[model samples]
Target: MSIAELQLPPSALHGKKRVLTSAFVGTTVEWYDFYLYGTAAALIFNTQFFPAGSDVAGTLGAFATFAVGFLARPAGGIIAGHLGDRIGRKSLLVVSLITMGAASTAIGLLPNYATIGVFAVIGLVLLRLLQGLACGAEWGGSALLSVEHAPSRLRGFFGSFTQVGSAAGMLLATGSFAVAQALTTDEQFQAFGWRLPFLASAVLVVVGIYIRLGVEDAPAFRKLKVENRIAKAPVWEVLRYHKRALLVTIGLRLAQPALFAILAIYLINYLAARRDDTTSGVTAVLIGSAVGLASGPLWGWASDKWGRRNIALVAIAGIGLFIWPFFWFLDNGPLALLPIAMLLGMNILHDAIYGPQAAWFAEQFPVHVRYTGVSLGCQIGTVLSGGLTPVIAASLLLAGNNTPWLICAYISGLAVLSFIAALAAKDPVGDRLRDSDAHDEFEVAP
Candidate 1:
C-alpha cells in the first residue's frame, strides 16, 4: 500500500508531533532515572552501600547490584508488554515514568550502610529492582508510541526520538554527576552530593507525566480497539508463533546494549582505577552523549533511506572494528583523546544501531503483539548482554591482569552475532502500515 493510503484520519494524525515529544521526554526521564543508578554504581555505591571489602571486591559487589536491575527487567518487560498490548501504550508509558521517578527519588532518600547497616544495602537493591522494572517497561511503549503515530515514510525519523531520549538521558546523567562533583568536596560528594541527581528525577517525572497525559494513544492501537482485534494472550502468541522474530530481535540487540554498558558504566570505574580521576571519564561521556543526541535522528533518517538492516550491519561492523582502538585511546593516548574515544564508541557506533532499532523491531511483529514481542526480545537481550557485561568485564579485567583484550574479544563476538542476525532480518518498513490482524506472522528470511 502507498503511504497516503495508510494514513490515519486527520484527527488521529493531528497529535503526531505531540506524541513524539512525549515519547522523547518520557524516555529521557526514564533513562535519566535508570542511568543515575549506573553512574552511582561506578562512582560510589561500593563505599556507600557495600563497604566491607577490598576495592576490587567492593567494585564487584557494587556491579552485582547494578546487574540486579537487569535481572528484574524481563519481569517488567513481560508485565508492561502484556498490559500495553491489552490496554494501550500511553497508559503504560505514564505508569513507567511515575514508578521510575518515585523509585529514583526514594533512592536519594535511602540511608547509607554506615547509618543503617545491611538494611541500607537491602533497600538499595529493592529500589534498583524497581528502577529496572520501570526501565524495562518504558522503552517498548515509548518506541511504539512514536512509530505507530508517525507516517509510514517518517517512522524511522519519529521512532528515533525514543532512542535520542536515551542519549539525552545519558547526557543529563553524566552532566549531573560532573556538576555534583565540581560543587562538592570529595568527602561531601561521597556523603550527599550523589543524591541530588536521583532527587532531580522527581521533577522530570512530573513534566513527563503532564506531557504524556495531554497526548492520545497511537491511531494504530485505537483501530485495534475499534475492531476488537487485540490479542487475548500477547506474550503467548509471540512466543508460540513469532519465535524467529524474537530471536532476530534479540540478536540484533546484543551488541549495542553490551557495548553501551561497557563504555558508559564499566569504563568509568576502569578509567578511574587507572588514573584515579572520574571527572575525565564523565566529561567524555557527557560529550559523547551530546554527539549521540544529534547523531541519533540522522542515523534513523539514514535507515529510512538506506534500509534498517543494511545500516545495522554497517554499525555492527564498526563496533567490531573499533573495540580495540576504543580501548587504545583510553589507555595509551593523551587526555585529550578520551572524548574522541567515547564519541566514536558511543555516538558513532552505538547510536547507529539504536537509532534504527525501534522501528525495525516494531516492524518484525504484528501490532497485536508488537509491544510484547519487542519487549521480551529486547529485554532478554539486555539481561544477557548489557545487564551482565559489566560484571563479566570486571572479572575478565582481573583475570587478564587489567588488560582489556578479553573484554574486546567478548564484544567482537557479540558484534558478529548481531551482524548475522541483521542479515537475516527482512526490512518491512514498506509494509508497516498494513492492518495488524491481516498478517499475524512475520515474513522472515527462508
Candidate 2:
C-alpha cells in the first residue's frame, strides 16, 4: 500500500492548526497543575506541610510526596492508555485534565501539618498521586493528538506543540510562584501565599476543558475504529509485542526528566535550604523554560532534517559534557547571572531531547497500542529517573558535602544511558505513522 494511504485525509489535516492548539492548551493546564506541586514540594511543602525535622530530612519527606505521583504514573498510563486506545484519545485527555485540576485545587485548600497534623500529609500524598496519574496519562494523548494530525513530513514539528505547552506550563508555574513570593513577606508567604498558584489551576483547567471539548479525536484512532482494529487489551499488546521498543523509549526519556528534576525541582530546594537563597533560580527556571518554548520546535524541525535519534544524541551528549561546567557557572554566579547558566544549560541543551521526543516515541509503535506504548514507557522511565531524582539529588548533595559533583555525575551517567538507548533503538523516521500487530487481526475481516 502507498504510504499516502496512512495519511490523514486533506480535510482532516485542514484542522491541523486547531489540533496543535488544542494539544498545546490542554497540556499547559495539565502541566501547570503538575509543576505547581513540584515547585511547592521544593519551596513550601518541606516548610509548611510536613512536621518539623532537619532540612535534609524534611526536604526528603516532601519529595517523597512528589515521588508518589511518579510511582502512580504507570498505573495512570495503563488505565488511560487502554481507554484512549479503545475509546478515543479526546475523552481520556479531557478526563485527565479534570482530574489534574481537581487535585491541584484540593491541594491548595488542604490544611498544612500545623493545622491538621498527620492527616494533612496523608491528604497531600493522595492528591499528589492523582496529579501524577493525570500527568502520566496527559502527555501521550496530547502528543498523539498532534502527531497523528500532522503531515507525515512535518510530524516532528507538530508533535513539538505538546512540549511547547509543557514549557509554557513550567513557565507559568514558576512565574506564578515567583510573583506570589515577590508580593509577600517570607512569613506571610509560608503562612498562606503559596496556595494561590495551586488554586489558580482551577481557572486554567476550565479554559483547557472548554478548548479540548471542541477537538475531535486524532484521525488515526478514528481510522482504527472504522477498520475495527483497536486492540482489546492495548497495554498487554504493547508489553507482549513491543518490549524492546518499550524499553528503549524508557531509556530515551530518562535524561530530560532527570535533568529537570535536578535543575528545576532539586536545585530550588538545594539553593534555598543550603545556600539561604529562596529566589535565586526561580527566575532562571522561568527563563530557561521560556527558552525551551522557543527552541522546542527548532529541535523538532532539526529532527525532521537529521532524524530524531541524531538530534537526541547530540542533546544527550551536550548535557553530559556540560554538566560540570553548567553547575560551576550556576554555583559561582551572582544572583543576577545564575539564570543565564540555566538558560543555556536547560532551555538550549536539554530541550534537544524534549523537542523531538513525542514524535520519536509515537512512531515507534503502531496506532493500535501507540498511546499505551508511549505513555507506559514514559511513565516507567519517569518513575525511575524523574520521580526519585529530587530525593537522590538531596541525598547525594549531603553525602558529597554539599557539592554539585555527585549530582552532576549522576545526571551525566543518565545521559550516557540515554545516548546508548538512542543508538540501539530503531529510528522509524520514514515509516508510515506506525506499525501495529492489529493489522494481523484485521486482515481476516477488513
Candidate 3:
C-alpha cells in the first residue's frame, strides 16, 4: 500500500534487488532477440530469405514470417504459463531466454534462398515460431519477478521495466541495423550484415542465464509454496474460474499491440510503399523507437503513482486523438520531423498505460494461477491485436484508401473498452499477495 510498508525491512532488499535486476536485464535480452527478427523483416528478409517474383510478393512473405511469431505466441503462453505457475517464474525466464537466443542465433546463420533453396524459408519460419513462443512466456515471468520483489508503492515503476526492456530491445535492434547499414556497402550489408545482430544473441543469452540463476523466487510465491496453495491446473482453473478477467485482458491487448505494430513495424513498410527509397522512413522510425525506450519507463513510473487503470484510460484517449495527426505527418513525408516526433511520443503515452499492464494483469489472479491468467490474457492480445493488426492494416492500405483516422479510431475504441474494463476491475492495491488452491480464487482485487 505504501512504500514504507513494502520495503522488506532493508534486510531483504539485497535479494529483491537481485530479482529485479535479473528481470530487467533478462527481459532486455529476450526482447533484443525478438526485435532483431523484426528489424530483419522490415529491411532484409524479403530479399534474403523469402524472395518472391515481385516486390509486393516479397514484402508479403516477409510480413508472413513476422505474423507467424504472433500466431504461435498463444501456444507458447499456454505451455510456459502452466510451467511458470507449477514450477517457478525464474526457471521459465531462463528457458525462454535460451530458447529465444538460440533461435535468433540460428536465424543469423540460416542459409538464404540461394544457399538452401526453399528450406531457407521453412527454416526461418520454424525459428520465428520458436522466438514467438519464447517471447510469449517471457513477459509474464519478467513482470511477476519484478513486481513480486518490488516495494508495493513502486510496483508500477518497477513493473514498467519489463515493457521498458521491450522498447529498449527494439531500440537496440533497430539501432544496430542502422549502424550496420552505415558501415557496409549496400551490397555487403545485404550480403551478410544482417546476421551480426542475430549472432550476438548468444552472448546475451548466457548473461541472462547467469543472472537468473542468482535470483530467488518472489516472497509471495514462496509463501504460497509453504502454505500448500499451488493450483492443480492453473490454465484450466484460469479459464473456468476467471473468464471475465481473461476477456478483459484480450480486449486491452488489442489496442496496445495493434497500435504498436502499426507505428513500429508496419510504418516502415507503409513509408517505403509511398516513396521509392525508405532510408528516411527507417530513420524516422529509429528515432521514434529510441524515444520509446525512454517513454516506456516514464509511463510505467506514472502508472504506479496514479493507478494503472487511470493512466491507461488517459493514454488510450490520447492515442485515439493523435492517430490521424501521426499519419498526417508521415503523409507529409520526412519533413514532418517535429510532428513525427510527437507521433512517436504518442506511443510513449501508450507505454505509460502499457508499462504497468503486466503487474495489473497479474494482480487479478492468485499466485498459483497467476502465470496462466496473465500469459493467456497477453497472448490473446498478441494474436488479436499485435499479430493481426499489421496484416489488417496492410490490407486496408492496399485498398486504395489511406485513412489513418479510421485506424486511429479503431485503436482508440479498443482502448476505451479497456478503460471501462479497468474501471470495473477490482483493484489489488494494499493487499498482500496471496496463493490460491485450484478452487480458491482471490476476491478480484479492486
Tell me, by lDDT, which candidate is best: 1
lDDT of 1: 0.87
lDDT of 2 by residue, 1-446 (tens): 21254343455456576788898899999988999989999888887877587867788899888999999999999999999989999999999999999999999999999998999999999999999889989999999998888776677778888988988999999999999988999899988899999999889998999888888986667877988888999888888988988999999878888987888887787777656887777877888888887788777766765678777888889888887886676567577878777876777777888888888888778888888999998899998899999988888878888887998899899999889989977666622225422222211212
Q: Order the candidates by lDDT, highest first — what do you get?
A: 1, 2, 3
Residues 1-446, candidate 3: write the lDDT tens digits: 23254333555354466776787789889988887877688789989987769877787788878889988888888998898888889888888999999999999999899898999999999999999999999988888888777766566666766777877777778788888888899899989988988888898889889988998778778777777777778899989998988887776776677777777777777777765555765666667666766676666666655566767777766666666676777677455464355445445656766777867887677777888888998888878777877666666665546555556666677667766766765455422223222331332221
* RMSD of every prediction: 4.5, 4.9, 4.5
Scored by CA lDDT, what does every candidate get? 0.87, 0.84, 0.75
- TM-scores of all candidate predictions against the true structure: 0.93, 0.92, 0.90
Highest TM-score model number: 1
**Candidate 1 lDDT, tens digit per residue, 257-373?**
999998899889988998677777888888888988778888887787667876788889999889888777778778677887788788788988999889889988888899998
Considering summed lDDT, which 10 consecutive residues are worst modelled in model 2?
437-446
Assess the local accuracy of residue 355 in candidate 2 as a C-alpha lDDT between 0 and 100: 83
Which of the two, 1 or 2, has more lDDT? 1
Model 2 segments beyond 4 Å from truth?
Answer: 1-13, 430-446
Clashing residue pair totals per candidate (backbone < 3 A) = 0, 0, 5
TM-score between candidate 2 and the true structure: 0.92
